[model samples]
Target chain A: MIYELLEKHKADFFVMYASSKDPNFYYAVSMKLPDPAFYAIGEDGTEILVVHEMERRRAERESRVKEIVSLSDVGFYEKVKELGVEKALAETYAEILKEHRARKILVPKEFPSFLYKQLSEHFEIEIVSNPFSKLRSVKKSWEIKEIKKASEIALNALKFFLEIVKKERRVEELRRKVELFVYEKGALAEDTIITSGKRSADPHFVGEGIIEKHVIFDIFPKIRDSGYYSDFTRTVIIEKDEEIAEMLKACVEAKNEAIKIIKEGVEAKEIHDKVCDVLESYGYKTIRQKAKEGFIHSTGHGVGLEVHEEPKIFNSEEKLKSGMVFTVEPGLYYEKVGGVRVEDLILVKKNGCEVLTKFSDYVEVIP
Target chain B: MIYELLEKHKADFFVMYASSKDPNFYYAVSMKLPDPAFYAIGEDGTEILVVHEMERRRAERESRVKEIVSLSDVGFYEKVKELGVEKALAETYAEILKEHRARKILVPKEFPSFLYKQLSEHFEIEIVSNPFSKLRSVKKSWEIKEIKKASEIALNALKFFLEIVKKERRVEELRRKVELFVYEKGALAEDTIITSGKRSADPHFVGEGIIEKHVIFDIFPKIRDSGYYSDFTRTVIIEKDEEIAEMLKACVEAKNEAIKIIKEGVEAKEIHDKVCDVLESYGYKTIRQKAKEGFIHSTGHGVGLEVHEEPKIFNSEEKLKSGMVFTVEPGLYYEKVGGVRVEDLILVKKNGCEVLTKFSDYVEVIP
Candidate 1:
């Protein structure tokens, strides 16, 4: 990736550009790029890629790269007839990095601080911290097989939203039919939350229009041509009263006791202090007593190519390694039994983690 | 719009923030905030908003902010137990702009330059150029009724991709059934292009798989609860020989002679030089002679809540202002009948434009 940050910083190139505001330029040019093209890599590994001759034949059939040049292959319209399409796109990106003779570059920390203020006036930059979001927070083996095919299409769009929530009752048409059943199983939903009651205690409510009595689906998607992401959350409880059935059995036993203390080296704040010590030994109140109600947020995160990334189980100390991939999700809000999450998607391993949202944890909806 | 940039930069609080990399923070607190909350406006206009105590009960029911507050109202867990969670979120966003006593804060140019280098160590920031995307480049009458309800659902998903391209010849299953018919007609599609032949001369090709004899269909989207946006390109020429039927009648008379001189004050480079004077009086070659291919890109832009924004009908001098709204598409590429754009969606009026993508341009379907 960016030739291992241009041969680990003895930089002679690495560049990259907005690829629609850096998803580390599509994890370094896998390309679905919507303009602002550039790219680079070099330090002997050479890759190149530029763009904008009306996106040179779609970045030579969607990038693989080893020189895919353009800006009318240098002299971009003779520097846009003397420096104008905004200094002829930074002098044709400095004539395509002085035809690969580029010297000292690198970049990443979400580059484009206005094209790093116009190529830091011609060269020697640096930046860093976007090693494809710490190598997309671990996962490999085909990025965990495209996040296990986006967690099996977000567990078949949350079991097709419990069979269209007993013939649907709104919440934005059951989150547009679980985002068209995760775009007919090929993946690409976004903010797909069904949210209900007290707007499912607002964990970023995406709800609207009816469908109450405790809902919260939170599907999360991505796979469309391997952008790889997946997060799943459950909570349906249509008739489990006993105070949201013991707040969804303490959110499925605080997400199976913080996924039985994760794996490889643990301590993502000890699985968010073991889901805040089993939702504070079932008496609730969390954020370790900063308490904004009950078990307020955090008990999960780190999913691939950004469905929220990096270790973050919360109050982190980092550690947990072995091919990461996250989401433990032990929730339990309550403007009186509203949000009772349970999420899954695991993996970690080298001694413990795997789940990948096999589903079913607090869905009681048989009405 | 940030209270008219806090009474035209008299600035004393114009704030705003990341709401998913600022769509002008959902045009300033109309809210769908996916973190990086804070918002402001004041200088007597007072709006506030804040966030992150697990998003203060979903920004108090999706913001119309008079004040929503919450990094635990103020102390933020005693500044995250004394400046820890990344300097306790910049000391609880400086105690939520020192409870609105801010001092010259403005912002915008997509703010988050690492939270303006840590809120520029306390206020007096200023940035500008994002007055809700230049007041979302003019379209407001409920943002032109949510871009005419996303231009009547991208002209019924480009006439349902000409009846599913007479039996879906793949190209990702006709862009997943035209993004599940623009999500069962309520809007929220993305990069929906069906591209065909010679990858439709690469106007950012989104093509792949079977479909041939030319196709483009670029139906853009948006509406889901008025996040506005709507663009619609049509290029289906399945069988229209005679030099691709005279390059689709010179890209439909260069988008009808650039919408017969759009109204208000004209000059968006005179509708991209009258669609390059009817595609160089039909001999094509554009980028106004920078060529590289016939009629390459831009004869349209500006579209509400970003489907590309700001009066950019190409070589810009910016005018055409009557509550703007744009896209007049006029393309004409060639690899022997490869790209023939003809989009619509106009608006501009004062004595002229309207056509919010009424359909039927160069579609020619009967193979």
Candidate 2:
């Protein structure tokens, strides 16, 4: 995939530091290293990893790449002892690029400004908007399997959370139980939202206080072994009110409506529009009608390496293909009545979409 | 602090997206928002946050700043509808800067290159290596309190881990137990290293396999509410071998030696050299002597909002000041005998240093 990308751009090298939080670095190297080490794919599709002396052995052992060079090989520590870390890194990287005969370097759009300034002084640096993003949007069989495992772990954690929510009073306690459950299963459940009542109206609010009538439980866990993630949201009702029940019903319906339109070669915007149309028909205002209220956010987004990646199922013109995996979430929020969101992972199939999250969205914990 | 920085640099504005992972964005706003929204500090010290319409209410509620504007207020959504997200964001940001009359912008050195290109076309851009790093380095009273709390939580978690390690047979199981214990206490223990035997030789290796003669356990947990981190490392011996015991003693001694010299106005490099001198005297090669083996990494680093922050206590010339909290870690590794590391958080005082981690470094688990 990277070879095709480099060839198409006619670039001499696609250089990136594994240190940068850009997912492309991991995508190219297919390994996770602690420190940000240098990684590049040469014009002839030769992959190289330049790491510190301490990381050399591990890089050689763990990374899929064939050639792993130590920083000392490029005189990094000696240069650092003389010129300091920043200048030494810049010089060492420049030397390595020169060794590869790299004249045109294609870097991620989020490339570090300091490094860009240093590299641009020696090479024609082109800012590419994550050359691997398109490839990452379409999940491979292994990637799908990882996501499935992550989703299963999240569902189990959710089940544990629901069990606790029935007994636990505080939102913080419930959140802790969910997080610990996920961690025990070798996954991370960070930013798990367990908001109640009016606070649930805010999409990004990681909730607090006592568990109330309308509770939002959004669990997104990253699988430890594979760096893939699964996001699932379900607004549970404890002591349900009619208004809250109506909102929850509409949210689930809208989410299903969006999922129904998922297939190969489907326009992302069409799915979003389907969600908005369903919610609006149910007498809910959307971001399309008003800027600040009702169904405010996008229907969903592609989820893989990052929680939110490319091929956003918003008002996008991009068409979805068969291998693409994303989320089909539709939500409605009322400032007075709180919010209800139903989200599930969707894998685009040749004819239809597979809802990867097996747990039912309409969870009502009647305590 | 941001106002002072902008005035000192004589920059019209310091613009950044909340989306950027730079901690300065959160430091500037004093709020945590999920999405990357527009944020700027004007020449007149007017702190402004331009967020998505949905996030506007919460931003207003949560952020410490006075002025919080929605994207719609700047006609961002309409522009996005007309143009697209990328072009519209550029135009919206350009207009926002123009409204502030910002002709000169000082961005963080790690600023996104793609954004730099867009902003540079309109303004005089200067890349500043973390404008707030120096300020963040000096821990405030509240910040110190937060760090203290995080360290306490980590100590408790470490105690829990030690109890489990005494019982558990596998490194993976012990790591999972430690991680779950920390998460249950409202802190994240990601990448908690628990490597055994030769695998412990690699500092960054998050270890695996069964209980062995020597094991390295490095736990760094971020406090959930405060976002402060505490790092602690302790190499334990399952069955005490003479070589492993000697190495552990030397590591603990080296760590204490570095900590003993930590006071206000002490050069960071002197502390690093002290660790090196102690370790070298114990017949171990340092990074200064050889790039790869023995004590290869830096002695320690600053612990605050980020795990590894400024005031790196290494071959650094920067002097430590009162109220600066950091780590004093010294370790020695051999390919054949595995590694031994002893780390503890230190708070620089007017007279000396306060070791924040209360747990004893010496541990011998008999199976």
Candidate 3:
């Protein structure tokens, strides 16, 4: 599919290089770190993987590509010593393109210019739009399953926080206990947004102080082996107030309105506008002098290998896909009055979509 | 002080530029988003900060740089667009350097090459090896206070997990609770490493599963409004065993021994070797084969803006500094036996150093 996209995009052939710590490298080969693995994906549907000695074992273990060439076996580095590190990286990449006889190669915009410049020395390299992000924007069935598993782990941890510790634990202490619970459940919590009181007003407010009654527990976690994430947000009221309940209701309405409009082929930007409208209707103003103060950030974004992936679901013109998974989180904020946000992960299917998070909207625990 | 370094190095000027999302930009300008700021230190010891219009107010609120130039107020982006983003960036920077007109322009080596290429188009650009990491390596009195506050949050969170939460909460739940704790303490838990059992063997393991007996709880948090971070690691024995105890002992001993030799001007590699020797003496073999296996990864690294910063204290000839704050974390791993790591934030003082963490080492629940 990627090869077809490359061909359709008028790329004669593309050279894919993996560095020591690039996640894109991990995505292609499933090997975390490769000692300068190079792949040439030709328009003719031919794919070749060139790996340095250090990554051979893992490449052989998990690589989807069939053809594997070892650089050390061929002394690829020694051939480029005369060029130096900067030139060598470029020249080595060029060699792969020349070997494949690709005239015009499509490369990611974020490709390091030094290497890009070097590759252009041999091939007519164009900084092509990244198609990988779009491909990954949509989730697969297995991916959705993994997300569900991750969400289950997150929701369980929230349940534990409510049922177990009855007294007010230090904010940090609560975070640690929740993390341990989730970690034990075969997933690592991504950003555990446990903000409280005045701090909760900041959309990204990571709270401080002895976590008092009004606390917002927004947990997003990824399953280790699966590399799938689950996002959920629940406002736990240790101490209750009318404002808190109203804010919580506003948040839920905004989020639900957005979630309801999300489906295959739907405009992502329109969904964001709908959420904003819901918040504005509730007499809230956005922080950046916008309509809704609570919804300062985008409504939600696609979630996958990276918690925030591509095909932004916020104020973006990108259209939703059948397999795309995103969050429908809406928040309401008032500085001294505290804040409330309710979020759930959703997967766009053939028809409407499936909400992966099964937890209740309000899990009230009176501490 | 930074300007003095540029003068000493015979560079006419030095500038630090970062985009909106780049954290280093935040470090230099001390202002958050909307502030496209740059800290330009001239040979004459004149420090100038250029920020965008939207960020003018925040820049004044946060930064210490003497001159704050709001680009938008002076038609900076329009001028930049006219000058070309590259040429504009270069010419704007060159104008600052020309004020001194001494000789050379210095930039941090890690500065994006696009920026470098742009600046180099108009100025004699030289890669200025930044000592920011080293400068920030050692914690100051106030910095230590922040880290200690962060550590307290982490330790309290861990203790709460051990004492109150009996059943396995989902990993995400525990992480959220810990995060909330840190926020309440006026800080953000940068990343809390919560991995369990077999997952624990992988040092960077995160996410998924029921609460297992052997869980690795690594928490690093940054104090509110301050970028400084504190890191701590504690392995829990929900089900205790002699092997686990033995592993913990070896790891603690290795970490302590590594800290013993830590002084100003000591080789980073030597410290790593000493720790490795201690672990080996305890019948644990370092996995030299795979970088991810056994006692792989560096012994310690400088910590500040980012969790893992610079001046890696492993196989590095980089000399230590008095104010450098780094981690002296050592771990022992076995394929089936899981892993044990004891980490503490250390302030490299002039004489020896001070351990920032005051958490108990023993794996016992806090009553």
lDDT for each candidate structure: 0.76, 0.83, 0.68
lDDT of 2 at A175: 79
True contacts kept of each: 0.43, 0.73, 0.03
lDDT of 1: 0.76
**What is the full ranking by TM-score, best candidate first?**
2, 3, 1
Instruction: Supply every candidate's count of residue pairs whose N, Cα or C atoms clash at under 3 angstroms.
Output: 2, 3, 58
Model 1 residue B48 CA deviation in Å: 10
Which docking band does candidate 1 fall into? incorrect
Task: Name the fnat for model 2.
Answer: 0.73
The CA lDDT at A326 in model 3 is 85
Summarize candidate 2's per-residue lDDT along B1-367 as a digit string, tens digits: 6677777888888877646355777777787776687787787868888888778778889898789988888888888878767668878888888887888888887677877877888899887767678788899999988888888878887678778877677877777777777777777777788888877888888888897887787888888778889998887777878988888888889888888888998999999999999988989889878647789888888999888887788887898999998988888878888888999999999999999997777977777
DockQ of each: 0.17, 0.67, 0.09
TM-score of chain B of 2: 0.94
The residue-by-residue lDDT of candidate 2 on A209-265, one tens digit each, is 898887888999999767899999888878969998888888888888788878998
Give the 10-residue window scoring lowest on summed lDDT in candidate 2 chain B.
Answer: B15-24
Residue-level lDDT tens digits of model 3 in B1-367:
5666776777777777764344556655555553235777776767778764434444565577768776544444556536754456556666665655735777764464456666666776666556454455555677677666766776777776665446445777777666666665666663477777665665655435666666788888776556667788877767777888888888888888888888787777878888888888877776332333457656887767667776677765677877777888887655486777889877777778778776667775312
lDDT of 1 by residue, B86-171 (tens): 46776677667776678768665445444555667887676666666777788668789889988898888877778878876888
Off by over 4 Å in 3: A1-5, A12-21, A34-40, A46-52, A65-84, A117-124, A287-292, B1-367
